[model samples]
Target: MSDNYAASFSINQPGRDAGILPVNQPGRDTSTSEQSHTEPSANGGSTVSTRENVRPGVSYLAGRLEFEPSIASKLDALITEFRDGKSTKGNTVFEAYDFVNSFPGGTPETRKFALSEFLSTIDSVEILADAARRCGDRAQIGLNHADTTATPRIEYTANAPNDNALIQAASQIGSKRARSEALSDADVGPGRENDMDYRSGEKRAKLTTADLPWHSEALAARQDGRVSCQATQDLLYRYERDPGWVRRQVIISGVAPPTIPPGEWDAIFRGTPVNLDAVFSSVHHVLPPKEDVGRVGSTEIRFSNPEPSKRIQTANDWTTAWDDVSEATAIAFPHRARELKEYGSYIRSEFSAKMPSSHRKIILYDIAIRNFVQGGQRHLLTDFHLFSRFHSAIVAPDGVVSGSGSGTKPGSSSRGRAGGRKIDGSKSEVCHRFNDVGRTCPFSTASCRYIHSCKGCGSTGHGQRDCVQSGRDSRSTS
Candidate 1:
């Protein structure tokens, strides 16, 4: 009999579906034994069982938690009240619903909804007859039913916390400082790289070197044939000392020379040069001291406060003050070149320390002038002192300088004007004035009756507008 039973239990592939019993076989009874289903467990064990009908449970719990409640306390209270007195073991169908609710998962609202759903749908809870305790002396308070109707009427929710909220909460705990302010308070003492301002200052100084006004003036003067070696040295010295005076004397009048090259005949016919030293001496016995003629970083000079006598005490105070002015000016340029007006507004807001308006204007002008020069616009030097005024003057592409007031005189290179003189050999003229080569005269009307003399010339001038003699020479007698 044991051998027959062994033959019936034939081994097959693990997890293979149960095969149907054969209907007929040679010399065998067809319908003597009952058919059974065998299922393999993960531990290589197999269990034989018959099928039973089951009902599926509906999902109720979903979403986030809002309120906090003690699940352990509720579970203990339900277990104690719903138990039989004999062994304190046994729970009612309603107690099973409470047990499921007390189990962890889902928001407060979701759990309450699930409990209501379970109480309404569940008909009865049965403690199974085959239910047995494997371990002795162990306290078991819940229902001992093994199957519970072969399926659960209410499902337990698998709730997970929001990942984004968890990540955000983690990030907020230990934030870092901005990179610009990375220098620690310890690293910044009285003047030791204080608040990383030193880094910024160092960068500004390097940048200022490339765009200094004095450097621009030097290059322009060098191209226009004005600067000498000794003049350059004196210029540098003055820039290091009194930059304000250099501006008063020179860069304000630095206009670019004409771009076109003169023809050989045009050059030869111009003229002999005049003795300017003698002429200047005759005009004024004492020459204005040969001044520094560059503005390269000279915009840094801050004028001293108006003294009763209009002078400063020690040279040291003056030098220190000028250095401060230059440093501030350098900070504002090239970096803020495009947004100069905005930068000026920012400066006003930051200067609660009450900086002089003149100093602020000086720095702003430095930025503006550099921007103009870089944009390929010519700087038309106008006399600020003569006008005692404040205004911007437009320079035409043709190099005509026009302004609002009469006090602003555009310099001529002919009659010892602030721009100095250029000799023209074309018309036997000792003086060649600064003329816009192709520009119309700003003063001329359609018909002029005034004695129209050429600039710096007593003779009928070279151009058609002024030289009536040349006009007559060109006329035919026929």
Candidate 2:
């Protein structure tokens, strides 16, 4: 099965039909917004959107649990605090419902325990704060967890020790040793075969080739006039910090590029003109010591040799097999020819790695030439991630993903394409149907997860319907 980021962990993909908004991978970026829905009605009574919007009580936080009248009263109080708890716990209270709903479901007894434990935890430790960061970063436990139901009657999941995922994730933040810590000289050289920082420098530095500030500086120098020495220096420094990232980006950024004449590759990829060291990698291993030059069965006797042996080298030092990645980049993005000319040699090596040159050549060439979708929609380079486990997902002649391919579902890409009110919440993509034309989505509020915006400007506050920008139709944009 393809172990895409979310599927790699056994956690289910949480939906947000639960009267709450959604957050991206809320483990790192803690930004979230709180919103309430109310609409002017056709008959003047008023129309309401968003599901399960029951205010358990008037949102009065009592001095204690006050559960004698019924669990319902207690529930109302909790939900009240939860929904209106913004600014109480700082980040988490800001997240409100999403933070509470992130908990997985459990049995009645376990759930009951979960309810009290959750409240107790909230009343005590800073679990909420950490959880908000975790949700923003990883474990996208949006809203509709399999274990929870509507509020008042709402429940939290507690399946014994196995279910404190967000809690565990919260505790783990800033806990790992920074990648730059304690590396011997030999460990800091070129080639990044083992590094795997998916955040791409959004968080830690294991796979970050350089600090964001340095990238900012580099970006300022990204123009055509940047000197060759500067580019070399940048690439080398990135290699020194996170050699694997440079290589990874090389493979990642170029895929299924627009086709061209087959022979066009010959100029840059063929023969020995392009160096192997620029594309492939090598490993140096010290062999075991050899015995003295005397046969064991012969009359001559020899003692075991203890001297150190020579270090053998295995290298993918030559090949005319694959297209020259630099040339490919130059051809694909002609506008960036200057940048490619500067950084292409060091950057393009990522695609080759340790794989056989012939395989590399055949594979790259085959994918490049193949028809993409079922109806022949061409594959764009951005649509492909070569290193993802999902890359081999079976697709029919049409663009549809095959159900038979484990972990690769049809149209999986569209589920979160735009952000969500259902899944991404207030961070959802704008609702152009409502904003641009004063028409709500055909699928109503809960079913349609887009932002509610001013009809004219598509922004909040009194934006003009006439203010809607031209050529920016969110309804048909995707």
Candidate with maximal lDDT: 2
TM-score of each: 0.14, 0.21
Per candidate, the number of residue pairs that clash is 12, 23
User: Which candidate tops TM-score?
Assistant: 2
- lDDT tens digits, residues 245-265, model 1? 433333244331111111111
RMSD of each: 30.4, 36.6
Weakest 10 consecutive residues of candidate 1 by summed lDDT: 58-67
lDDT, candidate 1, equals 0.28
Cα lDDT of all candidates, in order?
0.28, 0.32
Q: How well is each residue in 232-287 modelled by candidate 2, as lDDT tens digits?
A: 43333334443333334444656522221222222122211222232332112233
lDDT at 112 for candidate 1? 44
